[model samples]
Target: MSALEERNRRVLVIDDNVEIHRYLREILEGGAEDAEFDAMDAALFGTGAGPIAMRFDVTSVYRGEDGIEAARRAREEGAPFSLAFVDVRMPAGIDGVETLERIWGEDPEMQAVICTAHAEVSWNRILARLGAPQRFLVLKKPFDAVEVRQMACALTEKWLQEANLRQGEARTRAMLIAVPDAMLRVSTEGRCEDLRAVGAPQLELDDMLPGQAAVAAREAVASVLAGGPTEVFEVEREDLGRLYEARVARAGEGDALLLLRDVTDRRRAELAAAQRQLHEETIAAQAEMMLALSTPLLPIHEDVVVMPLVGALDSRRVEKVREVLIQGVADRGVSIAILDMTGVPSLDAELVDEIVATARAIRLLGAESVLTGLGSGVARTLVEQGADLGGIRIHRDLGAGVAYALRARGGRAARS
Candidate 1:
């Protein structure tokens, strides 16, 4: 054992007689040839060899005042005496009762025995003065050595046990303080037995959760006690403008534990992400609709097709136009395809190339392509860009293109 553990086994002896202090020291701190050990060895083994002695550090004081001072000093040094033997009738200063009162005020865990030859004070008066029946003992003067040793061993063990209990309580308090949610222990009937807000600084039990919350919490607790699953509910505080998620679970013996966690920030983030996804989906649908309107293919006659170009025709829209024209010619099996640009606002070199490319694509599909709705500005743009519309028929409007396609088909029929 460390010296500190040995020091905790210390005893204090308070008496006016100098001889009483000497006797106690010899008995508590046993010598090599101690009479008590020798007697024990003789009884146990029928031998006179002294047995192993147990030693205790004993402090001696002549007066009650001096004994109280010694006890105070031991407490300050963190190595307090586990027990004190105080004489009831000390000639100087306070008596045993008064000295014990002062010493216990400083260290209440210190056990003590009153040493006296006469009953100078009544037992009721002594109990009234000390107010600790379990911690106080009475030992007549000229006490037995074996009784003293037993008292020292038992009281010291009791002191250590009580110290351990206090340390455990302190650790529990620290753990509760470090937790970041509001907690409550509620009975089966939903009565709040204990509540702690160690980490929730903003929570006010009185004002934050009042009548409605108590009712709801009790209902949740009832559900869990009925062998139902754990329950969770949201509580919104309009005054505080915050949201809390309350969880209730059975905690044995007809009671439940409630934990409330704040989740307003998390809820807001989820809402924002959902709104962004919806906006992107809406924009995609609108873009698809606009692409369909930009390239419209309609059959005007038997084996004839017409495509009208409209709006701003960027490179992306031009590619969409080419796809629609080729698919329409194959699906409809057209012999003549017409390009209409009546609704087009303006034309550039890029747009002129796109138009010429569409006409060439139609010819490659074994169909004659007729260009109609050729405004002066668009025709001039096609010429300036040197776009090649090789062997492609041109008309002023959609009416003229349809009439010429019918006439050409009639001429072919007559020849056959």
Candidate 2:
């Protein structure tokens, strides 16, 4: 077992006289050797009448310095002495009071008994040096063996209880450090009782919950104390420019526990994501409107539609043009789609490809595509780029395209 586990019954006796040391040892440890006498006593007077079996591990030291050294060593080894018996006068060394002071300085939990035959130092002087009468007992040189044993047992038990209490407080402090939220224990009247901070240490819980926040927390805590549900509220810190969520719950005895979590970062991320989505949607709607305006589809004649293209056709606008033409032709059920590019200033290979692709898409939907308003500059560029029209009908202007559509419709009517 560890030293601490076995330290409960340990005791120390400090005296220069060998006979005194021998007497204390016999009194403290002699009980175990008196088993035979105990049995006779038990047989004479029933088993209940026998002395209680008690044993203690006692260490004997010769001088005041030796006693202090032993106590310091025991403390460093984590098995400190529960009690010490020191003689008041030690020849050529310090006395009982000095020895006890030095030992207590190292191990404050150790209880001591000052042994003296004559009054070498006044009791008031000892008390003045020690500063407390709680841990020390004065015993005359002719001390009672039973009284010594009783003191040993009682003081050791007190030391163990104090050790246990210290351990419990240490564990509680560790648990508080492990929690991530800032916590405060508040009464129903909104008084802050206790505060603990784990992650958000800058939050001063000692400061009364501020302004409207104080009123909100007080109401919430009062409701909880009255058997209401736990309440949560959001409060913004204007100084820090952040947000926190406070959760208030009943902690019994008219007190409530307030747990605060900083949610500023999460809220900011959500807001930024929403703003980004809104911007993208707004741009998309504006682009759709511009596409419709740029490619205006007008039904100028029966069975024929005219699309007047007006902007320089970048790749994006080219895709827009293709979408408008394909959708317009299918929806209107027009037989001929006349694309009037009179306002288009120039042409490139990529633009020629886009125009051809639009015509192909319209033809697939069972509509014939007609090209008109081709200026000489654009016509020459198309020829130079080796652009292929693939049998798509062409006209010089909108009027010719419409006349062709009417004639074609009339011919089909006659045939039918």
Candidate 3:
């Protein structure tokens, strides 16, 4: 414990009788080592370690007005009493109820006990005058020494607990003020009261946000204040060229806290990346379409169709060629399907086998397959790969292939 926290327990006594004050001082201060008092402390506070031995610094005032003045001075001097014992009837000045009221005005945290001898003092009236039971208790004037000690210990401990809690809250608020994000404390109705900002000093609530963003901010605040969960929303200010993310949460009764941070660079980087990704996807799609269009199937005669294959023939491209040739022959009932591979740059042994297989598929559809425009290297590769070309005819070029098909079909002329 700190030196200040370990200081003597401060108590105030307000009564017209001087004997009552002396008796209380003796009971509180002189009963430190009494076994009965130690037992009472253990029973109340659950401390089994012998006597607490707390010292008392008691202040006594005969009149209620003087008690009030003393209480006020104690508070101003940074030595406020933790508890006060007040007698109900003080004939020289304001009564106990009025004196406690004035003392509370000075130090609202001060715990009080109203002492009265008569049974007909109207506790209901006293309760009505003072607000609630958490801060004050009533004591019969012929004081039980044990009860007095118990009240003094319990009420003083309660006051200390409350003081620690308040200090924690103050420190928390001080830390919040140093945060980089702009913060606002607003009422349920969206009235901004306290604003703390490290960077954006001019940043404010809904007024600073534009269009639907302002409306969204107010709605978020209302939702948090209505006991809903915390809300997160984002808004962009084109005028400032900045985007901000805001979070709203309940602070106290009927109050909401709003915190905002600038996310402009992050938002712009995301948009730029998205645009780049979309552009790359669009170019890839166009390339695929162009590749499909590059290999075109043309029908020159009634029963003859020619496809000029181009590009480096991978497995995927060769499979596409097979699909187009077989489907076209089935649809047109062509007797001769010629595959002219003049534009193909290169081929492997596996690709050569794939080409032979394509020709076989066309023959199965009741059409004669003609292979043309094979360079010396591709033809050499076909021989080296040991490809089966049993049902297909090979021609040197497209013209020779077309001429041979026409002659087999009774020498038909070219279409106009």
The lDDT leader among the candidates is: 3
Of models 2 and 3, which has the larger TM-score? 2
By TM-score, the candidates rank as 2, 1, 3
Return whichever of 2 and 3 wins on lDDT: 3
TM-score of model 1 vs. true structure: 0.61
Stretches off by above 4 angstroms in model 3 are 1-148, 163-183, 188-190, 194-234, 245-266, 412-416
Query: What lDDT score is found at residue 246 in candidate 1?
Result: 93
lDDT of 1 by residue, 1-416 (tens): 64335436789998898988888887788765676657878888886354345577899998888888899999999889888988888878888889889989888999888888887667788898888799978887677989877777777777777787888877876786677676777776455544544344332334447567766787888899888889999888877898889999988869888888888888999899999999999998899788888788887665777888876678888888888889989888989988887877668898778878878988999999898888888888988888887789989898888789878788553344
**Candidate 3 lDDT tens digits, 28-59:** 77654566777887988788555465556889
Model 2 bad stretches (over 4 Å): 1-181, 197-207, 226-229, 237-242, 252-254, 264-269, 345-351, 375-388, 397-403, 406-416
Alpha carbon lDDT at 415, candidate 2: 47
Best by TM-score: 2
Candidates in order have lDDT scores of 0.80, 0.81, 0.84
Encode model 2's per-residue lDDT on 345-379: one tens digit a residue: 78888888888889988999999988888888778
